[model samples]
Target: MASNEVVVDGEVVHCIGCGAAVQTIDKNMIGYTPESALKKGLENGEVYCQRCFRLRHYNEIAPVSLSDDDFLKLLTKIASTDSLIVYVVDIFDVNGSMIPGLHRFVGDNPVLLVGNKLDVLPASLKKNKVKDWLRQRANAAGIRPIDVELISAKTNFDIDRLLDQIEKYRKGKDVYVVGVTNVGKSTLINSIVRQSTGIKELITTSRFPGTTLDRIDIPLDDGKLLVDTPGIIQPEQMAHHLVGKELKLVTPQKTIKPKVYQLNPEQTLFFGGVARFDYNSGDKKHGFTVYAENNLYIHRTKLVNADAFYASHVGNLLTPPSEENKTNFPPLEMHEFKTTRKSDVVIEGLGWVTVPADVVVSGWAPKGVSVLIRPAMI
Candidate 1:
């Protein structure tokens, strides 16, 4: 009856961190421990399913795939509970990271929006302005959180203040931290656990989506719990289309150094074939600054030869999608926008390009990925 025991055949044991059914088979599955390890855990009365074990010990994560229907079912559970919702989002990919219809799921519960990866933004960017932007975007999406806080889980920036804010708003009610995948929810929780309980790296944190399969509850001092939910996997995320190495090439691991490009009316830039930006009808000389992974390859080319260049150099000059995913990679779909004001052309899951006002630009990404223009976040 203890928390760690596996009551053989009577009931299935679940991972303490991810809440997946612990089994000794299928290493590829969500909650898998070897037979010997399972037996040892059963005898010792302490267990972390293999996924959590790797995540804890080796800082590695195994990807688990889930259907949208399954994710919706998980969200539906939160609606029936009287808990405070902490909605975490990636500041870099605001549109792609938002869970559509989240307001419906949380019911009357007050939501707190936590923008993760604030450290990725330019240091010159004002925090209050960023928070205001987040609030406006969240309101437009029907998520009017009681408070909006910004933090970088990777860098531990503003974490202490964020914890204080969460404590104030929670008011002894249970807290549910939810987000779409790759938003740093697990990393944020891991930081909180370390700070609050002195338990180092208690939860699995990874760049992959669905790292936390089911809800994992961490007990708070007030007898309430802070639950970490599985990241809702959005198909529109460019992370889904990329492999490990390819993903690394695109995902920012540290503060980005914005790359500035001087463009003419008919210039094009390719972000490794994953995303492309064409300055179709801009001024003869204008600037486009890209904020993305520091190492992501950016190649400039004439607009007329852009197609031929891409066809010839997809895996070489334009790197990731890396030959392995070339066949599966959807041809870039173009979406044109004429920016009346200074804006960022965001290719969901990839990064954004800040363009000067009154530029006619065409942003492209693989089919199904979102390409939109939004007020510049920088």
Candidate 2:
């Protein structure tokens, strides 16, 4: 089936289900499912998938959600109880994964920061730095986690240790796993269940955000419940802006390579069709490697033509919105970063560039695309 065109901010966004092109009109079909559940056994063809059905029926909430505020409110309700908080974050997109002001609502609750997607980063990155990054991020979010650990929800990496930590901090209290969308909260839960109990009963997982609209509980031996909460989609994230297919491409499938290329001052490097980088003011020549999708195109140009080059050839040569985002894309901003400790200058959902010790560099990506420094994981 083909999708119908719906204009959003003068652009076309696809239907999450059926892949038929969609427009924002006519809630009867493609882009309009209720944000909460509908009555069960209502006579209708299979309009939504089993996931949506489960969300509507079980949770009574169609969780194709909005921003963090809604999610925070949901968390506040959960926090009203004495539950342990498992704050899941994407190790790959750490900055983008955080929910701002999360700590304020989680008062007096023990929080565990579980960094998902360690499998996505290069193995050479230091785990200590990764933990430090999580700590710093947690602090910035006003969260004070009792424990921080890295695990790959897909590969089951360090998941046992994570489970042990959960058991310890939870102290027989219910566990609530929360994160903004696409942070792999569902995958981590599934991995935990399989590892601890070996039960593979299906739980919700999706490439897009807001998959778990309501909480589902899994029993633990300690009289505690590991509850899966819906992932809130942050509007500022690049994931929310991308089409589903494009999102899958940008999502990391394996360990990343810190691909370093040497560039002179005023040289430019393009990251796929998503972002661009220029060595505005550095040493005569600086060596840098971008860690992103292998298929993404990286082209180097003189600094002067960089802006014009991007304006003319963003989706054409540099591409993710494929052809759609050529002019509609957000403006680019340059962020100057000076690294004293080794770090990865992350562009959130985009990719990151590894900087060696004592190196000073400037980075650029689309506006609203976050650029931050963290201790190098590789």
Candidate 3:
């Protein structure tokens, strides 16, 4: 059974190497390998497997990998073009989603900020506040977006509006979609393809950044193209450090329920066994509400056992980076926040802690996980 793999339709697919269900994007587990390699073998007059075929033909661009110079070169094309730029951002990790000099990259081109994953937030949150927060985040990144729209790439929420908006701003020109990795850019584009073109066959998708290293063009009405550009992976992201299965545990699926905790000074909240938040100094016994994946364990423990607990349980209880993560999780870092306005202190992809007004608190998480304060979403 050495050649158990098969060519399915036009793509070469294999039983996911990691033994997980063969999801095309699950890089850690089995089926997620590229299909282009298989395609190469088939074209050579050989019976190639499905995964390799996908890695070959459909993903003719090869594995979504490029040197920094290649990246800058590819991005320069977008920068020099007159196409409309659709910059996608994950609402939960706005700080991490930001491209510091995006304005310079897009150059005089109009940028439309698409805040994705809104379906993960609690139902009680205000949308206006979230929109305002996204506007501010784009401004901070040096991109003056004409409009900001929130959508859920997973659920296809507001995507039609996004398309309509693109059509409106694009003025019959091409539309270029761009974002850093793991912001669901592929998923969103796939959704758009299904709706616009009825093409459901899987294209290049991966949990890892650089999955779509090359620009893909999908035809639009009026001969315009909806181009999908590769997302850049930031070094400081927790997602970059995690294994596929561990990453599945951290990424949010369903809507998030903001878990409110009433805590006295000096108490610690452990997010699963991975990260710890110690309320070092706070007024009115800090009321902290955390929003994260429901499966991730959030525990209130003594500050003393925090380190030992993490050491004893990481990869077992705290899990993420799973057993397959190559890079060791960095040591935890602490950040102190004084809230003049009621805000959410976000732990990048993990979740957010909604701090009640007049509460002074300090939060801690893994070193690269960004802790940002924004107007409460819930």
Please identify which of the two predictions, 1 or 3, would achieve the higher lDDT against the true structure.
Answer: 1
Q: Cα lDDT of all candidates, in order? A: 0.85, 0.70, 0.70
TM-score of each: 0.92, 0.79, 0.81
Error (Å) of candidate 3 at residue 144 is 0.6
Enumerate clash totals for all models, in the order shown. 0, 17, 25
Q: Name model 1 segments beyond 4 Å from true.
A: 1-5, 8-12, 25-29, 42-46, 54-66
User: Tens digit of lDDT per residue, candidate 2, span 115-144?
Assistant: 988887777778887788789878977888
Sorted by lDDT (best first), the order is: 1, 3, 2
Candidate 2 vs 3: which has more TM-score: 3
Residues 29-109, candidate 3: write the lDDT tens digits: 333434564455346543322343454355422342246565556676787788899999988778788876787678889
Q: Give the top-scoring candidate (lDDT).
A: 1
Clashing pairs in 1: none
TM-score of 1: 0.92
